[model samples]
Target: MTTEITARDKLLLYVVGMFAFIFFFVQFMLIPALSASDQAAADLAVAQQAQIAMQDTIALSGTNAAAKTESWAALQQANASYYGLLSSSDLDTLVSNLELGHNLAPLSLEISSINTQSLTGYAASDKAEDTAAPGEIDSSDPTLATADTNAVLMELAPPLTRVYASADYFKACTVTFRCTGSDSDFYTMLDDLAGQYPSVQLRSVQIDHAAYTDASGTTTGTATFTVQLSVILCDKESVAS
Candidate 1:
């Protein structure tokens, strides 16, 4: 036997159907959209981080390039402050100045000896150029012949040795001199020498308080100074070559 439909029952069935439709809409459409939006936001954050890292790397590279340029400029300025190899006339002028340029009296001045020394492996380049084969590099080639000369002399590390050895070599000389002067005058002369010629190195100094007694019976003081100096010379420009 079938039961007859009632208005209240029909109204209840309609209400339940509407509630089920709303639940399915939230679960299938709204929730998935929200989840996809969150995933997109996470991907954008990762992309932004990658972009920031690339910008930082580019900035670091630029800073390094600028630093290298500054270092090169400083090196060039330091090289410019040096006096390269001296000629015969230059030596004569130097000696004259030492003897007469100051208030002190120079009794003797002499260059005892000059010896060849290597600032780098290129020290023997002059000899090599002299005995070079016909097919080998000639003196006209600037690559092997030119010198970026300087007077500062010191032992070099392997990397610097290769750098300097490409062009120049060093030669050193022993300079001995005796002079009669007051203590103040002696020190002044030394200061003058250092300012004018950065290459001159003071090796030793000896002072005698009562070195001489003249006919007037007045005592005089004397000082002896020994110095070593170096000059950078090119293979093709050297006299021996």
Candidate 2:
């Protein structure tokens, strides 16, 4: 059978087709394109944020490194100064100079003892007695001389009664000596020792002066003065080794 077509009907069919095409274009193409553009913008923003965070981390690391370097340099300088003082030979030379300078005195000056006792041992004793009797010897052996000296020194210089070294490079020892002279002679000896020896620190000093009449019955002259002195020895080789 053959069907009849009208112009109105044909125009109506064309309008319906145009409306369907417009709906599909907006839903499938335009809407998807807009969504994809929004997603891309979000990803770009995240990447920029990550880049900024990375830059901040790098800057902090640089600052920390510089601070560490400066601290290390300061520590090195301090170490150098400490080592220089420890290695100096001035202290050793001072001892000899003091001896020479005081040798001219008419009074007798003698180092009776030198002691290298352990700090621990000295502390262990219940009663710390540093001075020996005037004529009594703790031991007849010469090896005990150092201990005796240290004892006398402990009595003289209470501040340095006990000493310890921070490292093996530093050596500490004590010296004990007896001096018999007039008041003037004793003063001269002390002055010369201090002036000549920078390292010879006087730890202890004891002066025993007694009045006695001379053969002429004159009480004008000083009869006798007995002194005990404590000396410290610091040598570079002893410390460096």
Candidate 3:
């Protein structure tokens, strides 16, 4: 048996198929394209807002000769201080040298133990000035507060330059020494070490003294001193790069 479809029916079928295809295309492809276009427009708007904010910041900055000089001087001092740090690679050498040099002391000197903590752990407090307060050893971190030129530029410098610099940009080291030495020899060592390495700061010194009465009825004592030392260190990442 054979059945033939009329041209009118064929035309109707063709029209319906075309409409269904158009609906599916709109649902699957066109909607997603429209949504992506909207997201792109929103992202562009946000970027433009950020750009405008940065331009405003630049516009507000004014140039002054005196301010410029002061800022430049501070910058120079900071850079010098940064370069003065001990290279991380030589940390062992420094410890060994400290121990070896101690043997040359006029009095008995020996290192009993050593302990260290990274300065990166401590928050940078805007504390500094070359002066150590009267027995203020217990009051503050002397290592962080003394002869730290770069730390000032980074952490405590005037607000004018702080935005351009970071308080924690520079890396540093902290170490503690448990040692035995006579009072005179210990103080002498501290003073000399400070002079030799302006970059090194003495954080604290604790001494335990044991007094004994000799047969001559004279008293003698042995002082065990604990000294803490800290110094700037070359930025590990910067060197590796």
Candidate 4:
């Protein structure tokens, strides 16, 4: 006996096959495509974040550069304000001013000593240069001959205009002095110096006291104070009124 499928069975088979195909496509192909799209979006977000971070870093670098320039300008300004103090020639002027200030101060001061130095490590370079004989080499210094030769070459070298040429731009001047007085008097002297010279900066201050008994058995003591000041030194070209 031969048997054949009816039309209803064939239609049911067609519908079942369609449903299976749809299920497999969604499970294997469509779902994975959607997952891939989500992953791509996440990666794009991360890339954008990285780009923003780089931009921020660039901005910070520029800001730091500008800040450095401003700091350098401030240094120059400070140096200009101390043009007088930096000069060995100005030593007499300093003493004269101090003498005048002492007379005007509220207390009497006993000034023991006053000294000046260069911030460039060599305190009395100018004095040494003046005292050295022509073509003389300091045998104590191995590099002295080379240094002197370089100095002569530099002096003879033609001046080339440069945007940032400076003579020892990082250098400054230092002044130190010792005085004997009471603490209040010391403060008064400090105030006087600060008032008279705007560029004078107090670097260090120390006080020493000595106590003694006289014939009357009265207790008395004296205080000695030491003070140091710093002032920036600039090239003559940068000097301003």
Model 1: ten consecutive residues of lowest lDDT = 232-241
lDDT of 4 by residue, 1-241 (tens): 8789999999999999999999999999999999999999999999999999999999899897777567555655664555532445474357446644554221222222223221222323333654322223233444333454334323332131121242211344556666565676567767887877665556677787899899999999887766666544434463322
Model 3 alpha-carbon drift over 4 Å, by segment: 1-78, 81-89, 102-168, 211-221, 234-241
Give each model a TM-score.
0.44, 0.33, 0.38, 0.37
Against the true structure, candidate 2 has what lDDT? 0.49
Ranking by lDDT: 1, 3, 4, 2
> In candidate 1, what are the lDDT values of residues 96-124, reduced to their tens digit?
57756676676666664444443333423
Residue 2 lDDT in model 4?
75
Stretches off by above 4 angstroms in model 4 are 1-80, 92-96, 103-164, 167-170, 215-217, 235-241
- lDDT (10s digit) by residue, model 2, range 1-241: 9877799989999999999999999999999999999999999999999999999989899897777566545644433332122212443343334444554222444443334434333233213454432223333444433455455434433333233332111233444444444566567877866675444445566666566778989775443434444343433222220
How high is the CA lDDT of each candidate model?
0.57, 0.49, 0.56, 0.55
Ten-residue stretch with the least lDDT total in model 3: 105-114
Clashing pairs in 1: none
Q: Against the true structure, whose TM-score is highest? A: 1
Judged by lDDT, which candidate is best? 1
Clashes of each: 0, 6, 0, 0
